[model samples]
Target: MAKNNTRVRWVSIGLTALIIIAGIITAFLQAQADIEAVNTKADAIVKTSEVMKIEGCLPSRANGNNITRIDTRLDSMQREQRTAFKEILRRLPNE
Candidate 1:
């Protein structure tokens, strides 16, 4: 009976240790998964921000003014080209 009790005690202690180790490993795995999820979310946010920047969602006043100025210059240049072409056509001799 004494030998049986000792053996049972050791078995119980070994099972308890195994359970503790399993719990620790489970916790570590869960933490790793959580960290990966957070990193994925962070990467997604960064990509979204980059896309928004490229799409001009975060335009500054200075940039807006510069774009407007560029557009006005382009329009002026087009008008000048059209006028020059008309003048050249008028100067040409008719067949």
Candidate 2:
């Protein structure tokens, strides 16, 4: 009877310690996984924002170039009309 009691007590203590160690390891692994997931999500968000900014800026830059071209054409047309008007007025005065 004494032999059984002592062996059983030692076995109970060993099992309890093993269970606590396993729980601690599992918790640490879970925390590491959660931190990695959050970091991945943050990086994605930043990349998406950078892409959107680039896309948005390009269209406005194109629009500014288009505006400049339109202004140049308008100036050329105006000069042509002025020259034509001057020639017509000269002919009418001579007649």
Q: How close to the true structure is residue 74 of candidate 1, measured as C-alpha lDDT?
A: 97
Which TM-score value belongs to model 2? 0.57
lDDT of 2 at 48: 97
Per-residue alpha-carbon lDDT of model 1 for 55-81, expressed as tens digits?
764465547646777789999999999
Candidate 1 scores a C-alpha RMSD against the true structure in Å of 13.3
Q: Look at candidate 2 and tell me the lDDT of residue 76.
A: 100
RMSD for each model, in Å, please?
13.3, 18.8
Indicate which candidate wins on TM-score. Answer: 1
lDDT of 2 by residue, 1-95 (tens): 99999999999999999999999999999999999999999999999999999997898787874777778999999999999999998889554
* Per-model TM values vs. the true structure: 0.60, 0.57
* Model 2 per-residue lDDT at 5: 100
Model 2 residue pairs with clashes: none
